[model samples]
Target: MDKSQLLERVIELVVDITGEDEVGEELDIDLFEEEILDSMAAIELLLAIEDAFGVSIAPTELEREEMNTINKIVARIAERL
Candidate 1:
């Protein structure tokens, strides 16, 4: 998928995991800071991303800050793609 579509899918995964519709409501919001994402949720998102896009992100590959926003997550996945 293209970058835009990839980003949408990532947002969907985050919303599904967090049950936070606000995730898409604010494209660059800090998920962890908002308590929308924690360690486990981040892991879940990584797995979903791997399933959806075949991009595997080891936890060690990026710090939480690097993946705290939807835009950042999409950018990380795009780099692997």
Candidate 2:
């Protein structure tokens, strides 16, 4: 799939995991500090993204910066692809 499609899927999977409808929300909003994502939820997100994109996220890639926001995560995944 394309980058945009991958991003959309990521958003959908995040919403499912976080139980939020973020369609009209800000992409750069911090889900962690916002309390929208907890530690367990974050792990699930990482797993889901890896599974959906068929790309592995290395241990060195587990920085909080890369996962700070939805936009950033999507960009990271796109870079991997």
Candidate 3:
């Protein structure tokens, strides 16, 4: 899928799992700092992303620096794809 589509799906999954409608700011914004993503949320997001993209995300891939924002997450997934 395209970046925009992937991002939207991520946001939808995140919202569904977190029970929050607003995701806040832009894709570049740090989800942790925005309090929109925590450890639990991250796990849920990772699962959703994996299922959506049909790619497995290794646990070692959840680097804090690499996955701090939605844009980065999408980029990583795109690279894997």
Relative to the unseen true structure, what is the C-alpha lDDT of residue 35 in candidate 2, on a scale of 0 to 100? 86
Task: Give me the displacement of residue 21 in model 1, in angstroms.
Answer: 1.1
lDDT of each: 0.89, 0.81, 0.78
What are the per-residue Cα lDDT tens digits for candidate 3 across 1-81? 777887787777767877767663476878888787888888877888788888788767668779878678878888899
Q: On residues 1-81, what C-alpha lDDT tens digit does candidate 1 reach at each position?
A: 898798788889998999988788788989999999999998998899989999998988899889899999989989889
> In lDDT terms, which candidate is top?
1
RMSD from true fold, candidate 3: 1.7
Task: RMSD for all candidates, in order, please.
Answer: 0.8, 1.7, 1.7
Task: Give residue 49's lDDT in candidate 3 (0 to 100).
Answer: 78
Ranking by TM-score: 1, 2, 3
lDDT of 1 at 39: 92
TM-score of 2: 0.86
Which candidate leads the pack in TM-score? 1
lDDT of 3 at 20: 66
Which stretches in model 2 have alpha-carbon errors above 4 Å? none
Query: Model 2: per-residue lDDT, tens digit, 9-60?
Result: 8889898898889632789888888888887887888788778888788645
Model 2: lDDT equals 0.81
Better candidate number, 1 or 2, judged by TM-score: 1
